[model samples]
Target: MNSTSKGDRLEDAFYHYLLDQQDRGELIFGAYPPENCRIYRKKAYYCREREADVEFDVVLELYRKGRDTPHLYVIFECKNHEASISEVYVNDFSSKIGRIFPHAVKGVMVVTSRLQAGAEKVARNARMGIVKYDEQGLEIIADRRGSCFEHSFVRSQIFRSANSAKSLKFSAYHDGEYFSSIDRFLGSLEPELVDGIRPENGGGSLPVPYLSIEQIKAAAGKILKFADYESGAVDLVKVCQSLSIDLQFADRAVLDADGVAILGSANFGRKAIEINSHSRETRERFTIAHEIGHFCLNHERYLRSETIIERDLFVTREKDGSFNYERLEYQANAFSAELLLPDAVFLKKTAHFRRDLEMRDRGHGYIFVDDQPGNSATYDELLSRLSTHFEVSKQAIEVKLKKSKMLTDQRKRNEASPISRVFAGLISSRKS
Candidate 1:
């Protein structure tokens, strides 16, 4: 049995579990809890089209001042712990849903338990799905179901991750029903997936624009216009120091928390990055590194952009899915990507990227790197070199080649040129 002293320990445990899962995948994230959106549970409002009188538990308003307001959706409902049905509950919630979700293609349900067989029949009559806790963890997610806390967090992330959609809207959260500056991020449920990370051309079989992530980073750096690539992050820190005159660099924050960096003289003097106690070691470090990238690559863009206000860097979020998807937030993400993995750095070492793959451990996925230039020219040598260096399956190297644009279509299809289909098939079979 779970300890109930806190706000549902089992539910809280699941929240932690969700964090763990996000780390293993590619979800840029943030956390929004139930208390923040509590008001959304009890706000009085007229029905859509003024057809009836009703109040909303969660009212997701669409983006205001945005041309794309149609993209966002809102929902609200009560959560229960019981498995029994209540028609009164449905009648009230259904009315609210019809109002706020005027054209809502998606929905948010704050409900009690996952369905019981009898409850399912009742739910069908409501023309919607009920979000309930699954004790057995065997539920299919046709509807995006989560606990009050979990649902809020996911919706916040989803809206945040919409990336300049201008679909940012207001809702609930642990903090309250306010606007979140950075939109919510798309969430994932994996913790250790190792695919679709690097482009393939660097491995030397294709026309990948560059050799590696470093190269990609470098190219992006020029595109972003850094003062000097040689200075790299050191130059970036200096810039941050200068920006601190008008900025605030956060010394610490929980992972994916609503964060801001203060160039506060006192805060800067403390060297926020050096403070370990207040932030998540891994996430904070990663975020700092990412911010440094932005500093190096995007400062000019931000300074020159007319839409961003001096104090606009900070936005707010309610507990559930409430945020703004336009402007600076996504810009920061692009900055982080370009700074951390510049294109030139990766391009310079493109021929040798396969050599790094030798370090991959089995069950961890495959990697390949080559050393000898003479041997690097041949596909077999390159593949062998990558296998030894990265410890990845040869098939992975092939995909990497495809991503890089190194292999020719004929080689992949025909059985005659430098590589044969039959031969490729044979090599693919020996992945073990």
Candidate 2:
């Protein structure tokens, strides 16, 4: 697309994104209800100082209780460029907004890429907000009935103030706190504008309940019962149908993430989960189940825009030993595991396989498998059997086996071979 068209697309996408947030009663820019908030595109406001109409890319007007006219205006300027935005653009926007609305107005510069050096400083000096609207690696397979595409704001960054760090990896920030999504950061600002609209604990970290494996498994079991699921492999599509969630597969080029869950809103009609169509069947199944876990756990209250990346699916702890979004990812993964492979059914199948294979435990309270050539065949056989029956990947089956304490891997033990032992003795002798 041409540069102008690209810019228009970005502006249109952002406009709808704001509208969706308003429909969901989660729009934080105005802190007003949907009925009281009005959004317009390419709107022109007459400036008394300039003696002409000043056009803005997008505008959001907020009305107070029982008021006829809007009491506050939020002006948005969108820029789509291949290069970073410079201080010149920021200064011009700052000047325009300043001359037009002296007070009770907020100017936000929305760009498609990063800001140039010193641009942030200029924006901060102007008391303006910066939002990097990135749609990298996003492909729209289907639109919302061929009108507006179902885009996600999770990849975008919203800086209420330009004083924060300019890291593309983490974009949402307000008052030194980092948020995972734009909705989260916006919701935290002016939380009192609407009662009980802000997230609990009043920060970026989502308050994910601490759930044990048993608890997660029990929850998954209940969901299975709810779906009347009695089969070898869980049919996640049917579960979504029962729950009234829309499930779709789109051609996603993004490698870092496999799925995205756009929390249901009135504008969007219903909750939707989109999986990367290019992923393997097993991976797709896992992604669907993971999203279902989020829905079943009532994470919708806190999750406005969620992109399920590989790290979010597996990593449970941060480097500093704290759990933020990591905790939620962990819970979802545990739930997915149990939902795919129920304890009773899995254990019974395992026992049958063990009896048929005459596999003996190696005194580790479970069957031990290692890289040893003798055990390789048996290990592969067991994994293949379970993977085929469960319709999940062998790697997933192996992890499930280890977690269940039904198997042990001695591959690390092989590193301490006789040659290593001899070397260790030699080193000790030399020290002596």
Candidate 3:
């Protein structure tokens, strides 16, 4: 017979989990258990819209002891099931949250299985959150905080991996939304490059000259000289400025696009790079590096005019469900990966750190760098560490590792669940 009740076990698990998050300084209060905290288990709230009372799994709040306005409030609806969490569940949670709590309260739908397609988007649109926790460490599927905590979260690397719409623009730069930013960027360029910058014709009638892989590699090598190869991190802004390229940050709405842009010979008589200000620092750095690929590979030579603008040479996809593999975009993406985390250094660090990790025999999932032996880290920890050292996102590191055959290729070595295959597939598809 089971000793503990399921309800009691769930409550205890969540209580302890929150306590651990508190100790780790994940909570906004910055105090363990926090002051004036209230965790109402199986609480009922009257829903004005529904004209009925809805019961919640857990309602957690932390704020000033006597203040009328709460600093932070989170409502979590737990779902333990084999099926994935769908849009319907997310919509229901959003509706309940709207009726039950103030606008500032963040709604969280905690699920055991994965989230279905469009579910996360629904949650984000509703200003709610999603958490997928299991024996593996806590994976924040989606967590949209209220305005008060948003600034802090944006600055926190802990929540840096949240999914955003910006990633979509990389696939199709020609989308209607992207034209505004592209036009602005093109208009800012100098007349010389903007007016008559065309590829050197080589007897063929083709107007543009396609760069070879060797040429791209050579260009990347030049940029890598300015970076710390051992650390696999480059000062992209400094490198750009060294080449007379100005770095500019603009809002996403202004760009109507994702990623960064390399402006050839701006009106200031210098090259420029426009990065999406709303993106994370890691993302900005990668975008800068990607743009550097374009500069070094002489992609501007292909630009004919402002009206016929060349697609960004980093992330442009073609029809038939495949990326434009034979284009400058693919080459630039390849260059960015190689530049950000050089193969040799990346492999060496992973080999050494993973060896040490193996000796320690730590557990899986998110782990602090200096975590204890029994509470060891996962591939995610390794990726996070590399990301910090390399100044990129864990996803970037993971992709690099996979490309280098360190995360895959079982013939070389054997390790159970080197990384989450599901996560790897998800991230890979997202990139494509």
Q: Which candidate, 1 or 2, would have the higher TM-score against the true structure?
A: 2
The order of the candidates by lDDT, greatest first, is 2, 3, 1
List candidate 1 stretches off by more than 4 Å: 1-54, 58-75, 78-92, 95-125, 129-215, 219-235, 240-247, 251-286, 292-432
Report RMSD for candidate 1.
18.5
Per-residue lDDT tens digits of candidate 2, residues 147-193? 11101222223322343211222243333333433444454444556
lDDT of 3 by residue, 1-432 (tens): 242354345555665665544444344322323445566677787888878888888777655556766555667777654455678888888877776776657676665455666775676566455544332111121111111111222111112234321111101011011111111112112123223322111221222334454555567667666543335477677677667777776664332111223222111123566554434676556566766665666655442111001233323322233322224455555566557766666777777777766633334222223333333345556766787878877766765666454443223332323222322432233221
Better of 1 and 2 by lDDT: 2
- Counting only residues 3 or more apart in sequence or on different chains, how many pairs clash (N, Cα, C under 3 Å) in candidate 1? 78
Error of 3 at 416 (Å): 19
Q: Write the per-residue lDDT of candidate 1 for residues 188-215, one digit (tens) a residue.
A: 1111221322111112111101123343
Please list the C-alpha lDDT of all candidates, in the order they appear: 0.33, 0.62, 0.47
lDDT of 1: 0.33
- Please report the candidate that would top TM-score against the real structure: 2
What's the residue-level lDDT of 344 in candidate 3? 64
Q: Report the alpha-carbon TM-score of model 1 versus the true structure.
A: 0.27
Candidate 2 runs further than 4 Å off? 21-37, 46-53, 62-71, 81-83, 99-104, 132-206, 252-269, 317-323, 362-365, 412-432
